[model samples]
Target: MKVLFLQPPMGGWVTWGKHIAINVNHAQLAANLREWYPNIDVHVLDCRALEIDENTMIKILKDIDPNLVYMGDALQTTGVAAIHPRYKRAADLIKSNLPNTKICVGGFFYGANAQNILEETESFDFIIAGETEATMPELAKELSKGDPNISVVKGLTYRDNGSVKMTDYRPLIKNLDELPLPAYDLFPMDKYVGFNYVKKYVETYHSRGCPNGCLFCVGWSNYDKRGKNDWTKYRIRSGKRVVDELEILVKKYGAKFVCIMDEDFNVYRPRVEEFIDEMNKRNLNVPFFFMGRAPYHLRDKDLLKPLREIGFVCGLIGLEAVDEETLKKLHKNVQVDQVAEVVNLFRENNIMSVTTWMVGYPDDDESKIKNRFERIDAIDPDMMALQIMTPLPGIPMYDELKPFIQEWNLEKWDFQHAVINTKHLSREDLGRLAAWANREFYSKPGRIQRILYDKNYHPLCKLIARCYVETADKHAQAAMKNEVFV
Candidate 1:
């Protein structure tokens, strides 16, 4: 049987960056399917990398004429997380164009509501939930057998008569080392670009599931289903295994920098330290970045400094809300004082930091919101992102704010839109505040001066710093006319 894995066209936000990257997980899924059914012809169409449009996609599907279609909605070449709406459109078009083809959907969106997704997109015949490495192979074997009882398939959801049938969720993968390295070669490697902050980068996941139960985050709730393991529960691959993949990218694919895309890069302190040790011992000079919590950084200040010296450029710090009360509401374990200390630690080590802040949280009042903004101005990082609080489905924030949720469109959930009506701030007010934060933080000349004065500034640091100022100026000018806030 022939199978085609389709990654739909991503929105402009993902395309805005110079280099468009492929979803590592999608490549892994393709590789897993090939490993399972070696006889089955497998083809991958990454729309973002190839820059394929509706007509191009239609022609490709028609030409392949596969028996089954596996569409990935997790991460498009676009940087955004949620499945693009175009996936549904592509599935619908394929179903109409090729009646013999069976369509299936998987990835984060489907994981959230597998049954509804399959039903809503009438084109899809089945839905696979969680860790496609194992599930996809099992699903294929069952389908190949012409099994009519798909409901019996574990981690599957499908339509039965008028109702949706969902099987039990699969357990998380324990031995990540057992899995094959992601099929990066299957993608157009040259098309992928690192963000402005780094010269060249490849994204790799160290583990699945995060223990941090930050309310505004969907990742937190995602792991909550796995019983007592804290929402931040993490299972990491061996350092040798991680380094093995990096070596392949470096030796064959020419990856100079790696962006460790874990929810928190330092989840297991010993493992992280070991990983850093392995990289150093092997003389792996590849620079890397990661997502880290302020508290973690503070605790591991000594350990992190060495990593920085060994090409760890910068990372994203989740300073969700500047005010303590707002942070408490968001379930972010760190305090405001901790944020200041973390920033100082990064500065002391000469590592650049990109801090993320959320405004207009559900429990926030005008005073609290103002205080948050003031804190943002006071504790400004080298780079910052200010977004309105969005209550995504399956998260505690969503449950708490569902009554006040004014919109449900997936596209609008992109931090730019105010989907929920806050008690203290109106939608318009939130938009303005976001615009104000962008202008205030980026508009100041002193922001650049601080980076320049820092003792540990590298040559590449100057290049990234210039890019930040230019991007900020562009945003400020654009937002001034109330044209670019959304």
Candidate 2:
């Protein structure tokens, strides 16, 4: 009946924005299991948050001695398929130590390709495919009983008779309000921070799935069914429910700042209105962050005033690419002009616009890469995430990029590392350009002064600026050292 959610030693490049985070997915899975199956003892050992070493983790594992261990990270931990290698190694270590404890893996990346994960690793006993809130507790109930007739469980993947077996895809949870609140008491809430600086901060999700089916995004591919439904579906909690979590995080946990690490927010206009109204009603105007599309902000211009009025300090809405042709190739339904328009809009409202841009497309050369930088720089976002175009293992562009992929290490699947070469550039070339762009952008003249003295910049936004620069330096340093470059 004892279950452990184990996040192995994760830091360095594995961290998001060089800050440690509570594995929200781990917390949610354990919470749901405890709520539905109270007898099942759930414990979380988040090494990322605890900042433990291998020796310390092994010692703690022995102390806990859990019967079942879960390995998965949500959006916050940058828990894409890139972390698979680390989690797989940790699973092997657990098996060698316990010799009898069961292990399961799921998340935005591994779960989408569950059958392959089980086929490749003997260490993992189950894969909770798709949205795990419902499947996890059901599997836990069976595991607690000592006899797992796993075939009966839907949205699960396992090994059967020496072959990989996958149950039918579970239906999406349309009503997110039905789920119980996360078991925050189980987490070391005090240890988490945002932008690597905000002590009184938390990262959470208000919705699941993004309708924007960008080809290079593994997170979006997880929700897509790849059929007539195309974009498939997205499920979001009511505005009241989202505000309820914010209230608890602020009033109860004393959180001064929060990050809505949803894959994308502001998809549905009504839900956003509800969220704003509830926050106003509760008077919980603690500064916060969220991610959404450039077009959504433009479409919902009316909401910007209220959004700023209620402590919306920063947001991560990616520009993706600048040129129209590149945008079309990347499947971003945005005009070349909307990129700057949205950034200007957020700036006018005093919301720090944290946007993203990608380099290393199939036809990119030094000229194209430089053009990307010149374009995004002109957009004047408060923070820009300059990423090497990483085409991850199961994303829509993976197969097409497979032939060009020079690196097979799952650990390097993060966008920070270039895995595939374009027609005009090598992997090393892409990394070097990324390194150059990162240095050039962050070191722009008077950027620090603007962040430090600009009245428009929110205090938390300044923290985000500092965190972004530090993290960018780490990435740029790695590329310069050839640690990540070819």
User: Which has the greatest lDDT?
Assistant: 2
RMSD of each: 3.2, 2.2
- Model 2 local distance difference test score: 0.77
- Candidate 2 residue lDDT tens string, 213-309: 6777767445414222323467788889989988988888888888888767788899899999999998888998888887888889999989989
Q: Model 1 residue 134 lDDT?
A: 69
TM-score of each: 0.89, 0.95
- The TM-score of predicted model 2 comes to 0.95
| Separate clash counts for every candidate | 7, 0
Model 1, backbone clash pairs (residues 3+ apart or across chains), number: 7
Error of 1 at 256 (Å): 3.3
Candidate 1, superposed: residue stretches over 4 Å from native? 12-19, 73-82, 196-200, 220-231, 449-455, 458-486
